[model samples]
Target: MPRGGIGRHGLRPPPRRFRCVTAGRDYRDVARTQWWRAAAGAWLLGMTLEYIRYRIAEPDRAEFEAACARAAVPLASAPQCRAYELSHCEEEPGSYILRIDWTSTEDHLKGFRASDAFHAFVAEVRPYVRDIEEMRHYAPTRVAGAGAGAAEDTAPNLYEWAGGAEAWERLTEAFYREVHRDDLLEPLFRHMDAHHPHYVALWLAEVFGGPEHYTEERGGFQRMADRHLGKGITEQQRRRWISLLMDAADEVGLPADPEFRSAFTGYIEWGTRLAVANSRPGAGAAGWAPVPKWGWGVAPPRRS
Candidate 1:
């Protein structure tokens, strides 16, 4: 009987009649084979799968296989092609299957297939065009793997962990409430507006990875630095600012994890120091820059 052909009973004939092309062994046909069906059902829930099945003549088998490897290079580099593999059938030496996992059918069909790399891939395999017996895309009904249930690749940034804009609002409100009563810091903010806390929250939110509201709605870093020019901020005032903010962070439940607190306090120290320096008379204005993005135990590098 021909390989992979059905028997008189409507079942795949015994594998003994067929030779494994790659391994050069007799094939062993199994009953009720449902591997591909199960795989299709289990692995296609949220992803698209492209299946390409083809055959190569005896004399062209090796060259065709090499061409397939070369052809896959372009697909492998495409962001839409999440994963791919090529395998030769054990029971049919000339038979090959190419499986590519794509982010979406549109991503593969529209994005990758239209790209220059697709042309390159086609060129590599053009010689074996007649060997392609079947080629199509399939969507899996289910997917299971180590990373199948994983969340997004990016973790929440510092702003998210710090309870977002609302948390910063609470922190600023609490801190400024005390600032109004304090002998040392009150003088600097005596004329503060009723919405001072809101502005500060916007500034903090931008620095902590939340939004660009400070830059868009307000004047951003240059304006912030300009605020303190000629105020002659003292070291004692800087230290008090840090102390009060840390106290406010604690009172407002702003993520007391060691890593978080360390980053939070580090920024407070650095920012207050800069505030003090900028507050001095004759200090040059720092150029405009994006608000720093703080992370767990790290700060965005300062621009040159």
Candidate 2:
């Protein structure tokens, strides 16, 4: 008389299919039907996958592969380059593909190319430049992967999931309000401007994949970093600042889902730590760094 077919010793019985009388089908049948529907939907709204195809000559394939291995060093080190994979085609002997997963197209075009790493990367691959058949990025129209369930998430970027620029403005406004009340954090921002919250919103918006208004209107990352150059923020203050902001995120009705919160909190942790480092006296960190474009569960790699 074990409940739900559980054995006396606590061993579970085999899964039994219960029939749905209304639909005249078993539970497994319904599950399989739902799963296929989900798979189809996911295939319609695909992930962003970038591809770089190369067609090397038969004799030069070895040299090309060696060059690619060397070039990967600098590209792999780039903050924007998330995944760099070079593969040789099995059917076509000399055909190879160099695939890169970038945070975004702008991160590759504007950020990486502007860095010295690009110069080094280019030098290594220069010999086989002529052999490259196609070099382009692609955004998938549809994709399916493991754990894709009935609810096909279209995968909104952090900014969109956080409700875009207006949402960030609300978050920062509420956060600053809390900061003003917090005894530990208030002293650091004693002279903080009324517009500080709005500026912060723009920065968050840019970082979370909204728009580049912060960089276009303001001085971008350099200006933001320079502001913290000598504030001497303490560990206690940094922790309090992060805590207050997270509280504000909850208060303002931001997404409470694990994926969103993880990304959101991850950025706050990184940004606050950097703030603390930059606030220390005589820190020589780069002021002209590219504003990071954060995604679902990924933050940009810290530059050296």
Candidate 3:
């Protein structure tokens, strides 16, 4: 006996089963049970073919946007596609996730991995991306319900005033580069390779829609800032930096568009409030914030 181990190999033996269990079962019954079990397993497998999810990381937001646009073309051409959309992480700016629905797993396999368009697109967008992870699910545990001819669903409300996705990307990127150049934001830039031409593939993706954008590991933003806070920033310095950002917005051509100007103002106001919240001692030490989904723009007219 070694150190209270019950078995020689330190493994527990299987529990004994009753004789009645085996004796009562005949070969025909066991075969039927096995067949039904296999059928159920096949049904579950079929459900998995209906849903697919892809997780992508884009360390740089601009190039990510470009890549997202580039990935769209082949995906649109893909025959198995029933529904699809790209979503940016609410909490993490540079992260992207793509969700898609397909009729069947065989159809999806035939359209994507086996398709010619996928190869061409991969060659075009592979350089900008860090990694892509994909999973197939038997059922969508979380999804919006299909409405019964009620109101039409629209794009993310936050993007309406910015004139859909394109305007939003241009204004946001130009504004970020121009204003957020302080040490607080510089680390992200340093981690990103701006001069690397591999990003051009990403640029095409942004223009067309392909899998070029890469997402970062989420969380830990405020902690990273706290480590360098007192050394690089003061209360007064932070305010000045914000003002410089507003100036940069003007420089980067955001102020020229009234919609972007208004949206920027709202963003600044919300951000200032967020900073105040973070400053309170021992308040939400996680330093997380919610992103609003409603847009500053007016809603589109409903069709009859």
Best prediction by TM-score: 2
**Regarding lDDT, does 2 or 3 come out ahead?**
2
Per-residue accuracy of model 2 over 1-304 as CA lDDT, tens digit each: 2111111111111112322111122334433333222221121112223566678888887677777778888888998875555655566757766666566787888998999999999998898888878888765321212232322134566788789888999999999998999999999898998899999999999887678889888987778888898789999999999889989999999988777888788778888887898899997655344566555543222322
What C-alpha lDDT values do all the predictions have?
Answer: 0.66, 0.66, 0.39
What is the Å distance of residue 153 in model 1 from its true position? 5.1
What clash count does candidate 2 reach? Answer: 3
Candidate 1 residue-wise lDDT at 12: 23
Summing lDDT over every window of 10 consecutive residues in candidate 3, give the lowest-scoring window.
1-10
Tens-place lDDT digits, model 1, residues 116-173: 9889889988998888888887753212222232222245656887888889999999
Question: What's the lDDT for residue 225 in model 3?
Answer: 24
User: Which scores higher on TM-score, 1 or 3?
Assistant: 1
Per-residue alpha-carbon lDDT of model 3 for 185-278, expressed as tens digits? 4543455545322332232222221221411221223332243322333466457546765675565444345544554565455544445555
Instruction: Give the Cα-based TM-score of candidate 1 against the true structure.
Output: 0.48
TM-score of each: 0.48, 0.54, 0.30
The regions of model 3 sitting more than 4 angstroms off are 1-59, 141-304
TM-score of 2: 0.54
lDDT of model 1 at residue 189?
Answer: 94
Prediction 3 global C-alpha lDDT: 0.39
